[model samples]
Target chain A: IAGITQAPTSQILAAGRRMTLRCTQDMRHNAMYWYRQDLGLGLRLIHYSNTAGTTGKGEVPDGYSVSRANTDDFPLTLASAVPSQTSVYFCASSDSLRGDTEAFFGQGTRLTVV
Target chain B: SQQGEEDPQALSIQEGENATMNCSYKTSINNLQWYRQNSGRGLVHLILIRSNEREKHSGRLRVTLDTSKKSSSLLITASRAADTASYFCATDNFRGGGADGLTFGKGTHLIIQP
Candidate 1:
């Protein structure tokens, strides 16, 4: 509704193909995050942006990259998708640093790599 | 090792029963948050308890935090079939003044039978 909006909903990508999962929030949040959820592995942080013009690596940021060119959008990209990267990806944002504010999340994007 | 880990991995209960889930984290956190995910849906923030606070409640959900133990528990009273979902606890922290993001647990899959 008035919160976060994700694109595609789901995607099927071939291994070695490039892919980008889009995330945008109308809340004008300063912090945005990307996480991958896998069975038994929990949710692992891939990338995050504390504010516009600044981005950083998370717990697991090897194959994923993120950019926050503006306050409203933070898109996650995979240079070359891999099967291991095939999982449910979630995008979230908070008005302040995650440590101090509650995060609002996008519906999620289910990705499968073949 | 995961920054946050949930216990019991899965739980089952009948309608009108109470459901409890626990989470443990490794580092000092600014806050701990509980979220719910229905199947493949995006996460919905249920509650957030700050490091300085011990407990918080919203509607039928009650959350308790023990900073000394680095643990937290969520209790849902008089739960219903609509509560069937994966419940996760996330710890918000800064690593070396960087890597600002929430580390989530594997989560507990709660099933409320009708």
Candidate 2:
């Protein structure tokens, strides 16, 4: 069973371009999250969804948007990519929003904006 | 800003040696989780310790939490070349008594020299 899968393993885009990072999970998890990782920094949460229709802003939400159309998918979109937005993005999911539950992660997408 | 801060950014040791990494946070959390990631890959859940719990063990990994000092540590015993990866500590900040997400540290790069 593929726990989670992310599209576009790596991509390079021009500044001001639009891009979307897709994440899908077959686990039917109730909660999903998006995070970005930069050198010398840990993963930073960009957005999260507690359930299919409810979403919340995370620690780092600027320049990013996410939607949970269904239980299996959560997509992160960058309306206009910028050089500063280039980073490794990761998608994670959990059975519930409970803090103690283990979170499963998908292989990250490396995005570069020039 | 990053809530958890890991000490000794990098560590290198012999295959059989023990490796320890510490993480400190600013506020109280519901739980602390440890994750491991190989270069350019998604993170894998290692272990989790709750606020009320002190220590937890999984195989060769031992994790300790001290709420008084607002810190946590992950100890890997009998490390192997396969164990060489970046270790991260994530805290679920439920400080306000509501739903919260994880905040990751800079992570500790553990290199197992064979």
Candidate 3:
């Protein structure tokens, strides 16, 4: 009950439409991240926030944006959905950005762009 | 860019046997982690081994890290039907600054034949 939660377990969106995937964690973690998992490609980091009010791009940040208004939430937004963006998006968080820390992940949001 | 690459990509083992998956990374890392993802769910942290550490164990899971080789392996003993899932290795790059998120490798899909 006290972990990361992602909304709209699955969604189908048309290309060129705007969509935002919601992610919230109750762990009070300092680092929150968004990743897209595609077949054969694994999970690629899209964006990450180390703390409130600051965010950084990760390996694949194109066409996606994230905002960390506070420590509890990190939402990923796709400005214009593309068929290529159809994949499972995951939200994760860690106590800190330290390499030794383990991350907690939320049930992924399966987004399919038509 | 993907920093880690998991070998085999797919593995199959009989229940009660052991399953081993290997991962190799390109850059120096502060730590390595293993995670398991079920059919259509989020990833769960399995174990974490620091750069200075060689091997770590948690219950039936064993993780080995070799900084010199930039490789790590995950071994699950006494595998069960529930152990059938995709296992991934993630690395935390050793960049002086720690704002970056973990870099994940394409996972190894393991099937446990009961």
Query: Which DockQ values do the candidates obtain, in the order shown?
Result: 0.70, 0.71, 0.81
The DockQ assigned to candidate 1 is 0.70
Minimal lDDT window, size 10, model 2 chain B: B92-101
For candidate 3, the per-residue lDDT at B17 reads 97
lDDT: worst 10-residue window of model 3 chain B: B92-101
Per-model TM-score versus the true fold? 0.95, 0.96, 0.97
Q: Please, what are the lDDT tens digits per residue for candidate 2 over residues B1-114? A: 999999889999999999999999998788899999999899999998999999999999999999999999999999999999999999877554334468999999999999
Which digits, one per residue and each the tens of the lDDT, describe model 2 over residues A1-114? 999999999999999999999999999888899999999988999998888888899988999999999999999999999999999999999875444687899999999999
Native-to-model Cα distance after best TM-score fit, residue B99 in candidate 1, in Å: 7.3
Clashing pairs in 3: none
How well does candidate 2 reproduce the true complex, by DockQ? 0.71
Recovered share of real interface contacts in candidate 2? 0.72
Q: Indicate the TM-score of model 3.
A: 0.97
Give every collision pair in model 2: none
Chain A only: TM-score of every candidate? 0.95, 0.97, 0.96
